[model samples]
Target: MIKLVIIGSGNVAQHLIQAFAKSKEIKVSQVFSRQKETIIPLLDSSKITTNFNDLIEADIYIIAVSDDAISKVSSQLPFENRLVVHTSGSVPIESLDNKNKRGIFYPLQTFTKGKDVDFSLIPICLESENDSDFDLLEKVAKTISNNVFKSNEKQRKALHISAVFVNNFVNEMYRIGNEICEENKVPFEILKPLILETVNKVMTLSPKEAQTGPAKRNDMQTIEAHLDFLSNKNHATIYKILTQSIQNNGKEL
Candidate 1:
């Protein structure tokens, strides 16, 4: 079994612990957290600790903390020349402290508390300085995910930015839709099926092919109506910008 140590107690860390703890091929040796109380919900109290010196020897040490905290946390690790990896999309592999074998284990998924994540569907992006370590990361990744990818720093960074546009920005659009629904005294649940269908359509169709609605048709009247309907200045501006983008993309076809 591949012995692994996980650091941090946030959403990514908790999800990693949940997934790895159940995997047959990987063993979670220990989890380090700043506060035992915080991580107690996800891990056994006995296996979770506040002291780094108390950390056991494991095959891989995954630092799942925030991007800004990665360097500081890795630098503080007491060990050296071990397989130390960070689960960050944008942070480069070189960001890890030079004392150890550096690698990245980025799971391209939006992790939220209380939401169940199907590890099999989430793509695990792996990168490492050493070829052997890359294989090691892949081995651990495959235990949880069928979709494992080997990506370089530039490619991973670009993927992260694309994730922001597709996941983060799209989620913001959903929020705006929900806001409009609430303002009109309609249940946001009414749009759930449509949202699900739109996502499903994109799975089989190119985004351009999947495109529909007034913007795609260049219905200026409908676009103006939407902008007017969004009384909030920021919301109106966002609608205008996205509508412009959609029509511009349509023009390309």
Candidate 2:
């Protein structure tokens, strides 16, 4: 069995704990956090430690802490022989000291505490300092996900940027739409089907091919009407930029 110690107690930590618990090859030997309150009710009665030196011996230590805390927490670890990994997408694995084996086990999916995660469907990005470490990382990743990729630090960084665009920015757009609906007395639920369909279409069609709107057709009249409707400065700016982009791409409305 692969003994694993998890560090952190946030959303990502909760998701990983449940996923690892379901795996037959991996066993969570301990959980480490600075505050006991942060980890209570989420972690089982396995070895829990607040002192970094008191952390139990494990073959692998998975750091699921905040992006800002990774390097600091990693530098304080007691063991040098065990493999250490972080789950941050933007943070490079090399930030950790090179004295021991270091790797990244990033899951390319948003995590919410108490929310169910379909681990089999999520893609796992695996990277390591050397071939042996990479092999071990891949083995551990394959247990949780069928879609695993050997991504280096640079590629992972680029992928993270894309995620911010496709996930974070897209969610912001949805929020703007909801706000607009509320201001106009339009029920936001009216757009739910359209939103779902838009995402579903992209699964079978390229985003450019799935493009359908007045902007895609270069319908200046409709575009102008939309701008007029969106009086909010930020929303209007976003609309104008996207309209110009769609027209530039020559995508049919």
Candidate 3:
């Protein structure tokens, strides 16, 4: 059985703790959190430690902390030469302390506290210093997820940037849309079906091929109407930039 010791009680760490709890082939030996109470509800109190020195030796020590705290936390570990990995998308493997073997176990998904995610569907991006450690990470990843990938630092960096555009930036656009709806006293639910349809289209069709709306059609009248309708300067600016990008991309076709 692959034994893991997860350190941190944040969103990613808590979700991992819950997922590993259900795994028959992998065991979470212990969890280290600054506040033991944060972990107690997720794990047995006996298995949660407030002190780093109390960390038990496990096959892998997963440091699921903030990007800035990774190096500091790894440096504080009482043991070395053991497999240590972090669950960060943008942070590189070298951000880890040299006291231990470094690797990355980034889960490419946005996590929120108290929200349940199907761990089996989340893609786990793995990278290690050597083949042996990578094999171990992959084994652990496959235990809870069917979508596992071996990603190098460069590829991982690019994937992370793409995720920000697709997930983060897209969400911001939704917020802007919601704001416009509210200003006009319209129910935001009115856009739900259109949103769902747009998402479904991208599954089988490329985003460029799936594109629609005034921007894609180059309808200057409709585009100008939208710009005039948007009273928020920031919103208008963003709309103009995105419209220009879509038109530019369409030209390439």
- Kindly list the per-residue Cα lDDT of model 3 for residues 55-90, writing each as its tens digit: 998999999999899989988998889999999988
157-189 per-residue lDDT for model 1 (tens digits): 999999999999999999989988999999999
Clashing pairs in 1: none
What tens digits encode model 2's per-residue C-alpha lDDT throughout 148-240? 999988899999999998899999999999999999999999999999999999999999899999987778998889888878999999999
lDDT of each: 0.92, 0.88, 0.93
Best by lDDT: 3
TM-score of each: 0.96, 0.95, 0.97
- Model 2 misplaced regions, further than 4 Å: 250-253
What is the Cα-based lDDT of residue 56 in candidate 1? 96
- Comparing 1 with 3 on TM-score, the higher-scoring candidate is 3
Off by over 4 Å in 3: 250-253
Q: Rank the candidates by TM-score, best first.
A: 3, 1, 2
